[model samples]
Target: MSRVLAFPAGRRAKWLVLVAWLIILGAAAPFAGKLFGAVENDRLGYLPKSAESTAVLEQQEAFPQGRVNPAIIVYQRDGGLTAADRARAADDQRWMAGKYMPKTPPPPPTVSKDGKALIYQIALVAPPDKQEGNYVLDAVDAMRKHIGDPGGGLEVKVSGPAGRDSDQFLIFRDMQYQLVLIPVIVVAILLLVIYRSAVLFLVPLFTVAVANQLGSAFVYGLIKNTDLVINSMSTGVLSILIYGAGTDYALLLISRYREELARHEDRHEAMAEALRRSSGAVLASGGTVALGLLCLFAADLNATRALAPIGVLAVGSAMLAMLTLLPALLVVFGRWLFWPRAPHVGDSKRAHGFWTRMGETVQARPRRVWALTSLGLAVGVLGLLAFNVPQQTQFTTTPDSERGQTLISAHFPAGNGNPATIVANAAQADQVKTAATGSGVVGAVAEVGRAAGKVQYAATLNAEPVTAAERSAVHRLREDVHAVNGAEAKVGGPAAIQLDQRDTNVRDSWITIPLVLVVIFIVLLLLLRAVTLSVLLIATVALSFGAALGVSTLVFEYGFGWSGQDSQLPQLAFVFLVALGVDYNIFLMSRVREESRRHGTREGVIKGLVTTGGVITSAGVVLAATFAVLVALPVVSFAEQGFVIGLGVLIDTFIVRSLLVPALVHDIGDRVWWPSGLARGTRQRAERGRELAPDKSR
Candidate 1:
């Protein structure tokens, strides 16, 4: 059985593995560059197809004017806008009319009641063949360059819904550099500190660098050849996942290799033995995470579903590299890879380290140690009582569009740029108007765009588009519009879409959460082969998730000066935390089972914690640090998601895996493997095991 894993240990086999990987890397290179081209960032795409908002958005594709993204130009002066400011704003509209989107000229400009700001709204129409974001970005750049700066103490701000969105689009285009650079630098620093060996630190980095290229290229290929509609943001996330997860797998394998090398004289034999022992845990860890991520396919949200494939591709690719390329490199390089502190055939045995001391304490008073530790982590879980995920996710803090939105919202109707858009059959246009007016809509409903037999109406809201009042108004509009005898009317817009997304995501949580739990339970049960123990493992991970969420909310609220989370944050964070948090449980327990096969269950529990504690903690810290690098991203949602996952990994690492799990195993003793021989007082003969086992390896 070890022959498959030990294939890389052979002299010629290692060389062949390296050469094949090189070939794969070369072939996969071009597809990596084409990744971002296939992404569409439409907000409505995240909703279920049956949703009215989603239908309206999907139907828009058949219309010619669907290519347009609106832009708002706000000309503001401190006290009030003078004649020159108003004239300049007017000229700017005319300046853009023929030069920008000539055929579909933007309508006239409107001034605020206070007279300090002039609002000019324009529709930026993309060409028939062009991407909407790409075209909007070019037009925005031209609008910026064309303005230069409004003179005479007047400030011209390009803002509103489209402007804010376009600003983030530009950020996405430029974020690739920082995304790659930050993780590489951060991972390098952490690996150096953890390994404390120059060559060992660089090996996994080198291995992951190659793996990331190959993995990203393969995912890009999937986007290109398949019907998979991957979000552009997923690629950046995939990159970070590959490096972080790849290095983690490498660390575990190499640490075992070092231990085995100290026990055997032949480097090749030691590597083969290490591969046989470590591969099960490595494969199980990767599989648990991969399948847990796959459970996201049950989500109704497109973005959440998209993450499932991206995560699976990344994990599968990273796992293959660590199992194949990493082992080959280690085996071929021998102990030389360790450089300054290389493991030898003989090393000191029976030592006392932090984990050893911990194991000893757990053995003495298992119940007390775990109870106190559980109490401490449970206190952090109390913070979840106040955790609330908000609907609105901010893209930029200080974009001109954001400031312009505030000014326009304060003076005029807050939903100036964004309005409730209604789709109605032409015959019921009058009924549509009447229904909207009766539903407490403040503005008139007029047709803005045309389809074959249907028209679109733009109904301005009395409240801000993101406000609860506007959503309620939109909901009421939907009811009234549908009340029309034959209106065939559907209500949608910025507010409606958000309302629909919130509803859809809530539904998704209900579906995906239970499915994920079932999926994880099945995987763990198969690996551990014990029903009682698998259930216990799942329970602890679920508990950790609750505590992590509570702690994350407090940190985001107090530490980051943010009061709310993205609506999708809790669900997404749960998937990551449960899957990732359980990852440490899998790592620790896999070793304990191995030890139990040699010694009694109680003795094995201590041995497992003492042996695997350091590597698991190091792996956790590495993973946490890798995720924390996401703080470098300017997007608020990404930063929040990063912090939550990173912090959860640490909790799982230092608190859960290092303390909670070991103590539980110790206290439970043999029952952790119930219905099996080990749990029923069927103990391994330790005396014979000591005689056969090497002193250093034990």
Candidate 2:
């Protein structure tokens, strides 16, 4: 990866070419794609065809589809409906309809019983088809802005796929500002605060910026060649990868530079030694995270599979930067980078009474501490029982929150809001039609037509559309149609779609979670050589994930008033909760196992917690905070995802890693390493490894 871009001698001269090349290439490729309109394809294109996709496409072809784009035009009669208000509303609707505008015929208006709420459903040229209509999002912005004002009796809240895109565009823009700007500002402040030197403080920022540029270019190249579903969230992932991991590497390099300077050695030797010593840890840490992300491939969902490689590329780039560019820059700047307060080479440890006391308490009463922590996590995990899978196609749309949707809900039967369709085929046209209009169902038989080999019917139900009741109706409709004599029927609609998605998600979860756990468990066991330790670590991750999901359910369902989280959220949460959460667990446990070699189990847990706890805690806090920024964005799905992950990190770091693990380690004593053949071997090896590096301390 490092060899993809050559190393240069003079910093300013080298960076100038790098910057120019990136700008030109990044601008050109996407513009070319848009002009040519070539569909982006991926390696997954090679996968075998699925029966589900074939069924879905066959169903889609049966409809002489009405306008697919769903539009919401909300009218707020903030002032009571008067003559003037009514006139203005009528006029606006006429103006929208009269011109040969891009918009399609608006659906009939559904008014509130009290007359304050009014919504007109507008249709778009087409629904969101990936290839042809992505540009519709751009066209829909004009409608939303028109609704933002109070010109007509209706205060329009135009939403659909187009509205979602507009919302996401704005949200991503804001996130880019915060994710990039805040980290830069925070890091700058911390650098100055810690180093008390303006020049040295800026050095890390400069190095990180260059690293980000190259990393982005690499990702852009991959995106061009592959059909990854890169979205706004990719921006945050890239920024964090560069800033968070880059800082850790910079800290290691700068620390070494200071140590060598204080030893009165030259800059080059100091940097070489720092690179040699720190590179192993840096490589191992980055490799662990990259491998953890790769586990997302086990997911049946396209989203996870898409994101996995992007994350790997970004992290891998950071690792390269840490090894090459950072070291080179450190060599160039020398000890003067730490001017003013200057970097120190003395004992790096700082005493903290609070952590020390906490550790001693756990060491004294391990059983009590373990019991309390376990009970707390169990209570939190109970929230998972109420976990609701969101019904909408897009995560941002919610039935309860939008007044336009609520108005639609009231006037239209639940199933009518989004109707499931059935396609029936039989030898006799009458039999197919009979199956299509079969009774004992929630939906009203709205339309029936006979085609060559199939009878198509669009059904709108009497219940709330896409609700549990509506899904039941859809299922019943399919069952009833299939039960008909000499005919076959297939069902598809929003409700049916939900059922399909739910089924897919459940299947994916089962497949991915166990696979990820087994892989991670095996890796940790091999790394540590203790079965008991592996079981404890995996269990901790599982508990942490459950607790996180439970809390997120409360936030999304009750606090934020969202319908529910995205269907894929649980699977995504499990991926992060297990993978990243266990990454920290491994870091903490490795330290603990090292300490356990020297002292007894009770003493070892405490020593490990005291030694590596701060670093792990800091990493967790940063990761959590970075993810928490998702909540501030109005996209409910991403918000739910971010909140779940952020909460997981917080709980894992402060509550589980800091408190629970230590208590369990202390309570178990030698039993913590039991049921594993390598317990004695691990101890012996740890002892020998410690002796080989006796002068160094964690």
The window of 10 residues in a row where model 1 has the poorest summed lDDT is: 389-398
TM-score of each: 0.95, 0.78
lDDT of 1 by residue, 1-698 (tens): 77988888877899999999889888877776666666666555456777888777666665666734567787888789888777877888898876766767677778888887778777766665866667777788788788887677888777765677677777777777677667888889988988888877777888888888887787877776765556657777788888778888988898888888888988888888889888888898888999999999888888788889889888888889998998888877778778788888778643648989989888999898889878887898899887766534365256666777777776677777676778888788888888888788656666787778787877877776555676677777888999988878987766778778777788888988898899999998888888878888888787777788888888877777664677777778788888888888888888888788777777888888888887888888888887887776767778887888888889889877877878888888888887666676636455566678764446
Tens-digit lDDT string for candidate 2 (1-698): 23322242234533554465457446644543332122222112212124232253355544454323334455556555565655665666655545313434544565666766555544444344643233444445555544356665444555433344345555565456676666666566655765578788687777676666666666666557776555556556666666766765566556545655554355555555555544655665666667767877765555456567866776776776666666666656666777765544453445756678889888888889878988898988888887777444344544222444454555444443454556666364466446556656644564444555766566666656445666676667777677776666666654565566666677777887787788788877777677898899889879988988997787667776677567778877787677777777776776576577666566777887876665566667666765666666667767787789889989998988888888887887777887654355445566676677763433
After TM-score superposition, the amount by which residue 166's alpha carbon in candidate 2 deviates from its true location, in angstroms, is: 6.2
- Model 1: residue 448 alpha-carbon error in angstroms: 1.3
Show where candidate 1 strays beyond 4 Å. Answer: 43-46, 61-64, 349-352, 682-697
Among these predicted structures, which one has the highest TM-score?
1
Residue 436 lDDT in candidate 2: 52
Model 1 residue 686 lDDT score: 51
